[model samples]
Target: MEHFVVSARKYRPQTFKDVVGQQAITNTLQNAIENNHLAQALLFTGPRGVGKTTCARILAKMINSDGSEATSEEDFAFNIFELDAASNNSVDDIRNLTDQVRIPPQVGKYKVYIIDEVHMLSQAAFNAFLKTLEEPPKHCIFILATTEKHKIIPTILSRCQIFDFKRISVKDAKEYLKYIADEQGIQAEDDALHIIAQKADGAMRDALSIFDRVVSFSGKNLTRQAVTENLNVLDYETYFTSTDLILQNKIPELLLQFNSTLSKGFDGHHYISGLASHFRDLLVCKNPSTIELLEVGEQTKVIYQEQAQLASQEFLLKGIQLANDCDLKYKTSKNQRLLVELCLMQLASITFDGEKKNSKHFIIPPSYFKSKGVAPIPVQRPDTISEQPQEPISKEPVTEIKEVPEEVQKPVIEEVVSTPEPVINLSITKPSKSSSGLSLSSIKKKKEHLIKQMDVIIDEEELPKDDFTEEQMVSVWNEYAQRLDKKGEKIMASILQMDVPKLRDNKICIELSNSTLKVELERAQYPLMKYLRKSLNNYDIVLDITVNEEIEKKYAFTTQEKYEKLKEKNPNIELLKKTFGLDI
Candidate 1:
């Protein structure tokens, strides 16, 4: 049997040049060592697996080297020392380390002490090591590494030179993994490597570890499908397919796809969040300058650009909003699957024309009707009505007719009854030669006259004129007011209920305290009148409103007035007030 080694340990970088990302920190360290300006006490603070310890080891070895090939080849293991502060975070351990700092190096010019996880040291230990760290011996050089810099005491931080390390980028990590794969004689796809890099989330060590696991799963031939299956992650194609379904407004298919995802053991939250990211990526690919912001394989980038062309800016913005909202509501929602399905349906409806219908702001989509096998009927405009030609009328003796000016005369059609002797009386008026003066007020009055004439013509039509008692009218009026209240029109309902209706012939008269109430009722009279007439079965129903300022004045509006009114109602009320010494 052969021994298997993990890629993280087997492919670790040994030199400063070989370190990925954090080039600024690495270069600064190299220059400092070359210029002999290296600080004796140094602190390395950053996230895990970003080349902090590797750089520490490389720095120790490089400083010991005298620039000769043989010196560089020598590991100088005896001169370098490594410590885990997490395990030995005590005053005695720090005291022992300080004691060893006094001894000179056996092989190297400077003895290097590397303390990993330096933040774990106790307060007493930190205080004990501060003085030695502030003024270390010439032969001893200290290098401290920690993931959390704030945990360390401020006094200790002040004594050592700090270096902030950055997380490795996906591009740099993928390139490093590719180099490793080539060295191991393994064939890896670009997308497969890209996914591995992204899964690491800016950690080189984690990326290498994931790469090793994926390589073991798929052997030498590493494809995207194998990588996604091994990592249990939703692939880019899944998101791409979801987005396409949303763009096409295929709600049923989108729901099915979501069901499949859940059946495969993926969470609805994960699916929706990834869909939001997919929308963001498509938005990024919309413009040329922002294309670089997208982090995907070259082949996938082309696919994204093609999808971006089909999706508009408005659709993408709305899709992102809906998906993100669903994501936030997922955990709190009672029906988690239904919430995600609704979000998917909304995303699918973003670009659908039928969803826009009469207004773009309509929440209920027209597709609901189509799904129920209902076809929407188009409404026709009044002007679209066709005009039919009339037949010629037989000449007869006119019995009676009204005259209009010759210049403004329009044809009037009348029905004639056949008889032995038909009588017709027609009269014509000559146009006046004098022209009328034109003014804005005159034109307004003329318009009002025309409107009144049209209303009279409409009112002349025959309609039902059934009679109803005042009690019936009042009952119907109260019912309408209650209906208004239920519909959230409380103000209108109160106004309607303020006074009872009085029937005088076909006219229903109402008296209100002020003109404001009358005006409000008049504005909303059409629907009220329609309901009243239909309920009473009387087409001749008319609502007459009257306002009396004297009636308004009779109501007790102030405290003194109310007190006077109460005293007038009962003479003993004044005695009760005086007996109680009540102030009004």
Candidate 2:
């Protein structure tokens, strides 16, 4: 039996050319070595598993091997020295290294020292190593590698040439993993490799580790399902199914899907976040230029593009927002499951208009009842008597409404607006009739009458316009601001209170303190302008808003500012501060 070795260690890059996802850095080093322009001290820094230490080792070997690959690790043992700075980060360890640097190499013309995680060195040790780095012996080279470049002192950094390593891209990592799988004679799916690459997050070492683990679990055959199962990753199929349910406004189905996911031990927060990503991917696929941004398997991407076609850009954007909001609120929500379920319901209703005007702020579509038809639960309006004079109050047959599916009835809701009638204020109790007693013909007549009345109400014409003075406009503006304040729009009210509108020709020009206020006012421009026009009796009152970028800066709100203000009021305050040695 052979001893087991992880793929990360077994396939570590042995040559500069063998290194993946670092062409620029590797090419620069290769050119320097070829031209004999190698810096005595070189610093390689970047995130972990991005080939910092690996490159350091490769560079050390290549320099001593005359820019050729060494046949074996033992061949460079005499000339190459490696130190773990994490454990040996002390002045004494550095002194010993400095002593070793003075000795001439026996086998090669140059001697190399590779220090891993060099930033782990203390300030004193770094200072001690500085002199040797700045001016080393003629035949000695120093290669320092670290994941954190900021921790290293500037003095040491100035004396060395820096090489920043970037994370291996998903494409490059996938290719490398495929190459490894091919070499191992294992059959691997592209989606499986893509998932592993994404899971690695730009780290080749992590990717290889994941690949080995997956291979061990599933033998030599790898599939998307196997990888997802082993890694506990949320399946893309789940998202696709959920999106279909949402597009159909199937609230019950979406909630069931969420419940199924939760049953698999996936966190609610994770599920919601994944849902947001799924929507984002769909949105990205909607554009040609942005399609490349969608990171998924080729087959999965095709599915995404297909799903993207089913959803409008507006629906995708709103779905993403609702999912993100659910994710953000999932943590603090008292009923975590309910929060996610509500977000799912909102997503299911993204394209729905079943909710009434009273609950317009809420994103809830009609709740589907299994017992009733597919139509959303309709909210009953309070009955009111008409003020119009009639011959007499007649007893009429109640109307019976047909059960229509919500999707089929959505258009009717958009086309019909309920008309308000004056209440009779009758206190007398009346016997109630059952829905079964109502006739369909009577219901049809009542609906027709309601629609006709709504049409008449909507077709009503505006009053004739009359010119008004600037004083009247100002009064209306103030009144509008008061109305906004009453509606709990304090920010908008404050903005309106800050500036008075000026009548320039026929246009009403309003200046705001900042662009934020300007945007808010512009968003509500139609309604605000309509109210002002109605109150001032001017139909042609055009609103023009301008943002003043050079708004006056306000005083600081810190305790230091308060202390400084106090100091200016009394000279004795400074003396007291000096006596007490207070920190301000």
Best by lDDT: 1
Tens digits of lDDT, candidate 1, 302-352 = 999999999999999988888899999999999999888877876776676
- Give me candidate 2's TM-score against the actual structure: 0.66
Write one digit per residue (lDDT tens) for candidate 2, span 1-584.
99999999999998877899999999999899889999899999888788887888777777777544466655566788889999999999999999989989888778998899899999999999988899999999989999889999999999999988999999999999999999999999999999999999989999999999999999999999999999999989999999999998788778888999999999999988998999999999999899999888898899999999999999899888888888888889999999988888777766765433233235543323342363332222335434556454346743334566657565644443342432222121233242211233445665676445431211123545678888888998999999999999998788887778898877999877677878888888888888987787777668998977555334225787888889889979999989999777
For TM-score, the strongest prediction is 1
lDDT of 1 at 188: 98
> What overall lDDT goes with each candidate model?
0.84, 0.82
**Model 1 CA lDDT for position 157:** 92
Cα deviation at 195, candidate 1, in Å, is 0.4
Worst lDDT run of 10 residues, candidate 1, spans 412-421
In candidate 1, stretches whose alpha carbon ends up further than 4 angstroms from where it belongs are 70-75, 355-584
